[model samples]
Target: MMRSPANKIPADGEPELPGVPHVHVASVVSALATLDAEKAGLDALAQAMAGPLGAAFDVAVATIHNSHGRVIVTGMGKSGHVARKIAATLASTGTPAHYVHPAEASHGDLGMITSDDVIVALSWSGETVELRDIVEYSRRFDVPLIAFTSNPESALASSASVVLNLPVAQEACPLGLAPTTSTVMQLALGDALAVALLQSRGFTALDFRQLHPGGKLGASLKFVRDVMRKGDAVPVVASGTNMGGALVEMSAKGLGCVGVVDGAGALVGIVTDGDLRRHMAHDLTTRTVDDIMTPAPRTVRPDQLASEALNILNSRKITALLVVDGTVPVGALHIHDLLLTGLA
Candidate 1:
């Protein structure tokens, strides 16, 4: 194929590719049309959910909640892609789920589906030829089958124990043949199902953190104990220590601050670089730590979430928080630690 000159502009105002034909529609115009079609599909889906779909949705949520076994999500072609994502979302949000390919289920993979499991099948037309085997298997084993399709009267819907009849809408494809808006609605409905299940189970962010422990989100969910400086790394001085001694500890620990503890070894205050600047005087080093320390400084517990610690740092405009066990200082958390852990 011959290539057109990079700087050349065609007389029709369209890029002159070697084999592709020119069309009058601008790319942005086509994108807007696709978005409008998908938005219409979602709007239709929302309306259906508020009307006829509500009762069935409640039933579906109840069935899944009652089931002790995992969710087996299966679909064909484009629906299969969406099914995989749905399965992942479900699994990540406290529900156990797996995606089983419709065609693969025919070749001994059907054994993966158990009588106790619920099958979620997706097909826009509800007549995908590849889903027949899985559908038949669900019936033979008496497994509850949930079907997602626009045609409630089709074979798959008729066979399903729960039918999520999606509202019909035009496809985003100009030819009206591709699975654009339809797939978007399917994915949205799948997300809705997963969220409903999550809420029903009272799934929490801490639980979600367990499933996603290798990302920035995981770092944010970490506890203060996991990132705080412990033992000798924490800079501390007795409540009556001279400012010189407190400054020495702060500089030695390099945390920009030093925790001040009373004779009982309980954190009573904190002296920071700002304190030193504010108390600047020829006799500064002669003064006691209590003279310059900020009493009842904002503190955090070791068990508090790192994100919460970050909130304190941001809201109070402070660089460090002393982690305490009751009244005793156990550790110190510096802003740098949060930055290193990707929580800041």
Candidate 2:
């Protein structure tokens, strides 16, 4: 064992300083056991879905699709938290959705719901009192109701057009009163619904980018064309151009590299600073660009995501890449460009 030089225990208990207590191995084991139990509960929920519940999921997806308005997600207590997250997930994934608190719905927030919209009500016990008003309103207005709960016979489930009754499982909480395991089931089921709807609607990343355009995620989704230097800014020289001219172009473009193109205007090779360094002994003024260029250099497409370009640059250990459409060089991207845009 390596001890720090600062360590100096008091000799013969002259004074034992107060210190952080060591964690008990038994407590660690118990915590791990709890996780295992929760995972098993989730697993049971998955298994239960293989039967009639699977059909109910399909029906729910179809109901949401056929609706002309947004999905109004309603719930109470911890279930309300899960409902809000589910609503956000659905909205971001192309299915328009919003959370409406059941208690608030009774106090005129119910007006936010329309007959054209579908209601997704969540209640672990399926008999939450706050949900009664909205459930009754949904029934009265002929609004489709889909329920996610643990009790099929409860009011919420009985009133729903589609009831997804989750399998009962023990809570990870020792007191068996906290919402732990039940909330996990609700969240997982909600995620499944969102993904199913996303796939059904053919939701693409581009559609997602439209909804989320203010973070690293949005930056990662930006296309190469959005950041690449195009036209006269791209450092290019004819294939037979002299290395001195190529170096001049590389410097002028300030990307530390120049692209070599053939007579047909097709990119044939690239000349980087490293290429110049390796050919330093040669007469660069007389050597043709092709004589010292790296042929078939790694290239990115104009439509590729910036993150994809970053991956190419990082994996190749290079600073710049030529953006091409097939064999023709259209643009160039330097690592600094990505850094400037917060995409790196």
> TM-score: which candidate is best?
1
Could you tell me the lDDT of residue 317 within candidate 1?
93
For model 1, the stretches where C-alpha displacement exceeds 4 angstroms are 1-25
lDDT of residue 330 for candidate 1: 94
Q: Put down candidate 1 lDDT per residue, 182-279, tens digits, no spaces.
A: 99999999999999999999999889989988778899889999999999998999978998888889889998999999889998999988998999
Off by over 4 Å in 2: 1-27
TM-score of each: 0.91, 0.90
Residue 229 CA error for candidate 1 (Å)? 1.6
Instruction: Give the backbone clash total of model 2.
Output: 0
lDDT of all the models against the reference? 0.93, 0.90
Q: Report each candidate's C-alpha RMSD, comma-separated, in the order given.
A: 4.3, 5.4
Give the per-residue lDDT digits (tens) of candidate 2, residues 218-256.
889899999999999999999899887887898899999
